[model samples]
Target: MIIPAIDLIGGKVVRLFQGDYAQKTEYSASPQDRFDLYVSEGARYLHLVDLDGARDPAARQLETIASLIKNTPVPVEIGGGIRSRKDVEDLLNIGADRVVIGSCAVKNPTEVKEWFRDYGASHIVLALDINIDPVSGKRFIAVKGWQENSGVTIEDLIADYREAGLRYVLCTDISKDGTLKGTNVALYTDLHREFPDISFIASGGIGSLDDVRNTAQSGAFGVVLGRALLEGKFTVKEALECWPNA
Candidate 1:
């Protein structure tokens, strides 16, 4: 599936270069307009991130997100600054199909696992941002809006969650994110092969239709389109066409 993504900062649609807040670009389109546009263009699912909430949970834009969810007909998954059960509950209560847990999941795996049990695996999605060491070729998980390295390997984290019935995982390659270069096909390919039961959603560096094709062929269940879609590099319909049976 070609899942369209909208990153929000102060209720405005925006995108950050490599997850850096200082290097941000805000789009003129409102979140509602962008959502409607994606729906019109054949997007089946949507990903929303609250940049404000990501930096500070207390500043979460719940009212704005709730309004968007109330209007969206398709499944919408929301993330950013989701650190507590109340945060997850608030999103789900407001009609979010899935609540994506990132830094909290890394900081408190036990607590997150309980959430999967309480909410069911289908209702919870784990967002793991990865940083690869250029010299050692090791992948480490980054948390807190990609500001802190958790010092935990992706393999270990997923393995731990697999026991708790983990269903969906959104994995992003920080190096390629917002760069418009290409996706980390090899990473998703290896992950898909290793954890065939989990639905892995590949994110970051989706620049062209061919990137979508490669991701689909990599066995990823879905791909999140951000900058490429926002910049009109291609439409959601064109991206879906590149994936067989999407």
Candidate 2:
């Protein structure tokens, strides 16, 4: 499935190159307009990231996010600066289909695990942003809006959540993110092989329909469309066509 993404900073639709806030590119289109367009094009799910919230929990744009979530017809999964149980509950209460936990999942596994057990696996998504070592080629988790390295490998963290009833994992390769070069097919393929039961959503570096095709072929349950869609590199409908029976 093609899940359209909207990264917001100050309630404006934006994209950060390699997760760097300083290198952000704000789009002309409004978030509501983009959401309407994507839904009209048959998007099954929508992904939202509160960029301001990511930098600081106190600065979260709850009103804007709540408005978007309340109005969205399809399932919406939101992430960024989701640190506490109240954060998860508030999003869910506002009609968020799933709450994505990134840094907290890596930093506080025990608390997040309890959330999984309490809220059920289907409602929580682990946003495991990966930063690969240049020399060692080891994939480590990048947290705090990709600002801090948790020093925890993707394999190790997922293993910790395996018994916690982890269902959805949104993995983004930091090097490949926002580059429009291509996705890391080998990485996703390896992940699928390692954890066949988990539904891995492939993110980052989606430049064309072929990228979407390759990601789906890599066994990704879904692909998140961001800059590519906003820049008109490909439409949501065109992306969906790339997936078999999507």
Candidate 3:
């Protein structure tokens, strides 16, 4: 499956580099316009990220998110500032197919595990944002859009989520996100090899159709496309051509 992103901030559809609002690219004034375009482009699964809302408190895009869920035809998997049971339940109630928890999961595994116990596996996804230490060969899960490092190891984090009974992983390499440099292909492949039983959703640095087909072979269930599609590096129809419809 192919997943398209609809990242929102301040009621507009925008994207930031490595999660920095200063580096944002204003695609559309309203997120609803982008949502409509993604649907018309043949997207079945919508990846919605509340960039500012997820990284900070006082970030409430629920009204906008709810509107998207209410108005759109496709199923949504939303993330960003999803912390408590109420948050997850509210989104699901508003028709979010899944809720992605990031910083909270790294900071509080016990709580995330509790969430899995109550909400079950399909309802929750562990969004792991990895930042590779260039010289040390260590990967730390970045929180707040790489502003703060959680210092959590990939092995330990993935293992903890797996132990908690969650089988889905949304892995993104922050450094490659929106750079159009190509994805961290080997990282996805390594994680896939390590956890063959889990389904991984590959994000960040999807530039060309070849990248899509190549990464799909790395055991990713789906891929998320952003700047490449938006900048006209390629079209959604071209990317969809790489996948056989179910």
Model 2 clash pairs are none
Taken over the whole model, the C-alpha lDDT of each candidate is 0.93, 0.91, 0.82
Of the candidates numbered 2 and 3, which has the greater TM-score value?
A: 2
Clashing pairs in 1: none
lDDT order, best first, reads: 1, 2, 3
Worst 10 residues of 2 by lDDT: 142-151
> How many clashes (backbone N, Cα, C below 3 Å) per candidate?
0, 0, 2
Provide the global lDDT of candidate 1 against the true structure. Answer: 0.93
The sequence of per-residue lDDT tens digits that candidate 1 reaches over residues 9-43 is 99999999998899999999999999999999998
| Local accuracy of candidate 2 as per-residue lDDT tens digits, 1-246 | 789999999999999998888898989988999999999998989999998888887898889988998788888999988999988888888888899999999888999999998889999999999998989989999877787889999999998899998989999998899999999999999999999998999999999999999998999888898999999998999999999877
TM-score leaderboard ranking: 1, 2, 3
lDDT of 2: 0.91
Pick by TM-score: which candidate is best? 1
TM per prediction: 0.98, 0.97, 0.93
